[model samples]
Target: MADLLHSVYVADKGLIFKVSGYSQNLHLVVDLVTREMRAASGRVDRHMFEAVREVRARSYHNVLLKPHKLSQDVRMNVLIEPYISVRDKVSLIQNITLEELQDFTDRFLDKLYLQILMQGNIAWTDAIKISENVLKNIKWEGLPEAESPVIKVHQLPLGDRKLRVMSLNPASTNSIVTNYYQGEVATVNDTATLEVLMMLMEEPVFDVLRTKEQLGYSVFNLVRYTFGVNGFTITVNTQRDKFTVSHVDRRVESFLKKFSKDMNRLSDKGLAAVKQSLIQLKHTTDYELKEEANRNWREITSCEYKFQRLLIEAEAIDKVKMSDIRKWVADHFAVGNKSRFRKLSIQVVGHLPNSADNATQGESGVQDHSLQLLHAGQPSTNIQENQEEFITSIDDFKKSLPLVNTPRVELAQC
Candidate 1:
């Protein structure tokens, strides 16, 4: 809601729309505008016009002067959308003096910049000035004619590619890797595209690279669930010892080059297997009850992706052709992975596999003395799936354990 309000707020002036009739919602809406909240929504009130003008002169707008690329402008795709009539609005519950409005607007813009735009790559100070200038100078021209996005990957030759995942969306994390991977063109957005892309990698990446070859402990193929709560990420966790981050990176590149699916689509047998695997993973064997609770918690906490895992039938993905997968990867996974954080952080105590040399203690700098191993190539962590799994607490362990009744309330949050 806050994001929508911000987009609307930054789009131009204050929003103005009339409902068939609104009763108690008017005051509530006005309160939000006055606060200058992000993506906030409210009813249009008499004072909102003045507020918009005030914000224009005061708060920074995130107007993109050259937004053609983001909106698929190259393909000549233009979006003309209708205004939605909102029933809710912000209310000015606190006594905000008019004298404070201008300063508040400036503060509001500052908060917005800090909250969203500063990706740690850029300094806050620099972003502030840039945002201010961009907002102030924007011509506010009408929406541009949408066109096809630049097909950067489509131009790649067979030899030039490394690894690729199909269409990546900025809204997702895997899209980030998909782009950073080989030259595969990624066609990503919403659910359909993301699902197809994920299905293609789901087994091959896991069985071949992670399980068989032992690439990274965390290296398991993943299908993204973007429908409910937009999601995308496929992590490969390994210690630093086995492969320099660079070596794994290169291997993935090589793997992508050879793993082409231009001819054969997912076979019915493949689809059925994938479907069965998915079903197996979905139902928590009564023993995996904590898993169920954890899922429920996520669903309750975030409105997105709660029912999504249950909703999508994985069998639907079997129809995706190998060509589609290749093209998608080629497009989205071709570039831009330097953006992620690699703090080289080490928590002194975490889940180190029992196989680790426990006798060894952290030296002045463990980066050297401590071995770093990738999950795939390294020996198993000596973990037993049958053993008591780690949950938030023993209570959670019972929640996940196969049983008829909930665990006694002896233990609390851990």
Candidate 2:
């Protein structure tokens, strides 16, 4: 008889498999190996192939035609190492034959280890029986576990800045600009600090850039953690008919520079209030059953199995002083700290009446002056003088920053 195994051990180190649901509900994820082995047995027919092609084509078109998706793709390409897109996947799908996919799936499947996770109301015996029943149908011969993929986290080089303008929807008048600041590798403490800082900055950023300056309709500031790397971004979605990307960039910089002064004035009482609000939010027992499971699943998937991470963060937040928050802001946004500051700016420009001419005018009038101030290497009376200088070319931007040796995520071999 096939083995019906159930073993309990601490997952000290390894890749994660996540399952989310209520305690009474069962969730099963057939590992890639088993799924691919089944696929390799030639289950895919011509109809399935055509269906997949059509689905992928539609997805590619949606991404291409949607301005928000296009802007998100630009942001991801800038942030992710060895950037690959849905378009690239679609291209690959179009180029490969069904037989090729089967072969490739077989080879790739041979290189992956299997993981099984049971949560909620499932009993150990039930899990064992389920696993056994699933495996009984597959051709796997209890092969030894294969290695896991290595996911490399990309680090933005210090002092280097990148600017990308992706044009999408030539007929749409709306444009978007996103500025990303490369932050330190995430730790519980640092992540907590950044979260509080974002809370402090969010309203002011919007009030100044959106309401007061009238730069755009949508203005947002938030902390973003990609893989294990932490960063913060300020995004504005405006109309090319009214404003250009350069103008938005300038206004954002101006707000941030002045915000530094505001940071200094953030009284102990103000800091305390923010911390209390965050603590209250974290301590709120508002998790539904599924929400709780999903939160645990995220912890497992991120390899930070502190199921009570919010509590841990709350404790960290308690110890965070106003000085700590100021230091973090200074380290990231301070002028002349070239070795510690890096930014990536992505602009999605829309088509409108003489938009190209307006964009040039904006760039020359705003960006040229800013660049000149940066090149002068002298303190300027302007509030935006401390902003990171933008580089037009990706290659030049990469050259200015130090690269981290984070391992690239790759398929592992058996």
Candidate 3:
């Protein structure tokens, strides 16, 4: 029932460790959690793998303990690390027959060879061959057969002795899908997003809150994403101004519609460029063998392997029209009130209101409180901060500056 598992793992039943096995050529870091375990980095080997193996083997729940550092005996010091209880040592027990242990260890060492090939300091074509071999050798029971293009490759080509490749398949709607299967939502928060933000600020949230009700500038209109979860997320920060509870709802609804309509006007070239850039990113990073291994394992256990076909599908993406993108945005990305969303949090940075019509909402029609807060908070503020603040009239400001701080050259008006 845990989300991620950060405990240690052993293929040969703790006899062989897969850490530092790669030396400096590769590094594999694993942070196992409940229900899910994450192992990443380059390749690792026996000695370093032993260290990681020990840390995980000696953990109490999630806290790792170094077995060697426990006590002086090295023998007696085995299980005395901090936060470790003797009862927690029960997981270390192994009941396999020596034959079973030997076979498991053989499998571990065999896979370690493949690990070098897949995660080794090697070439892409060579690594691909190694990956195919790794898959062939590390067959666990009930694992579905891997088809052609069994891997979705993410590669980074550097013109050096060490070439790199990174790939993940996202087949599951959950675990290892991005690594083992295909599907992700790439949002465009570029100039277009900024333009949208500016337009949405049309009825500046401040007016809606202070003029009608009151709120702070904690007002936000974002096109965000849930960390590794698929989908686009929009968040509205409502601290700057306090709005009538109903007005907040209505404004959010209105803003979404306008955003969608604008998206409908996006140039085809722009959309295509963004999509292409995302797709091209598939080739930017190199793959480490451990990632490939865990990703495959996760897919076999938690996702589907067919996700390897993502890149091709993505490359063959349909030429999207402005209307199509707009509809897609509205369907998947818009921020209207829905079951997936809620008023996440409403934080008022300045003085907050205790009343339901929150004291922060201010007198029904109070002048801009920010301006008021400004004057009230600092009576001796600087004049440069003002947009139209000047001792002289516009004409006088232009002429009089000659005496104050005139430019040396005959400055041309921009």
**lDDT per model vs. reference:** 0.33, 0.65, 0.30
Q: Residue by residue across 367-396, what tens digits does model 1's lDDT show?
A: 221112223212233322222111122122
Question: TM-score, each model?
Answer: 0.31, 0.77, 0.31
- Tens digit of per-residue lDDT, candidate 3, span 1-414: 223222345431122223334432222222111112112222344456566555644343122111111111111111112122322342442232334444554444442222222334656775555445434444423322332112111111111010001111111011000000101322222223322333333344445433444332334333332221222222233321233222343454454566556566657776666656545653344466565555444433222332353354344343434554444454333242222221211111222234232233234421221111121112122222322221112123223322112122111321
Winner by lDDT? 2
Candidate 1: residue 341 lDDT (0-100)? 15
Give the C-alpha lDDT of model 2: 0.65
After TM-score superposition, what is the CA distance of residue 203 in candidate 1 from its true location, in Å? Answer: 4.5
Backbone clashes counted, model 3 = 48
What stretches of model 1 exceed 4 Å from their correct place?
1-203, 206-218, 223-242, 262-269, 279-294, 305-309, 312-327, 335-414
| Model 3: worst 10 consecutive residues (lDDT sum) | 174-183
Flag the better candidate by lDDT, 2 or 3: 2
Better structure of 2 and 3 per TM-score: 2
Candidate 1 TM-score versus the reference: 0.31
lDDT of model 3 at position 212: 48
Error in Å for residue 207 of model 2: 1.2
Residues 1-414, model 2: lDDT tens digits: 322222222232333434444433332334433344455448879789878777866567556545567767766655655556554654565666777777865664344344455665778987887677556545444434344433444567655354545453445777788888878778888888899999999899999988998888889998988777788999998986787677777778788889888888889999999999999999989556656766776665555566788899899998889888888878888453445676776766666765453343332311111111122112112333323554455545444445455433222410
TM-score of 3: 0.31
